[model samples]
Target: MNSGMDPHSEISRNLRAVYQEVESEEIPAHFLDLLEQLDAAERSQSKKDTE
Candidate 1:
């Protein structure tokens, strides 16, 4: 544990590095449009639910 080489900590560091790399990438425009479409659909569904 003093060496900071515990398996759990190693796995966590590797996962954090992977997450940071993925987080830095740019999202495609089509994906953004799809997300917006999803948001609109959810809003429509919620409105229907309230009624």
Candidate 2:
């Protein structure tokens, strides 16, 4: 724990590593479905705007 590095930089580096680990995991099926629904809604809105 005492590598002579500043504590703030060490903490930030650790937090970023943890976040990258989480970001690499697969997203849940439910969340993917919700994202698809949002995309569909945006397309629908675009079509309405064009009309």
**Clash counts for the predictions, in order:** 0, 0
Top candidate on TM-score is 2
Assess every candidate by TM-score: 0.50, 0.52
- Clashing residue pairs found in predicted model 1: none
Task: Write model 1 residue lDDT over 1-51, tens digit each, in one string.
Answer: 386566578788898889989898899899999999999999999999999
On the 0 to 100 scale, the lDDT of residue 27 in model 1 is 91
Clash count, predicted structure 2: 0
Ten residues in sequence with the least summed lDDT for candidate 2: 1-10
Q: How high a TM-score does candidate 1 get?
A: 0.50
Error of 2 at 18 (Å): 5.9
Candidate 1 local Cα displacement, residue 46, angstroms: 0.5
**Deviation (Å) of 23 in candidate 1:** 6.2
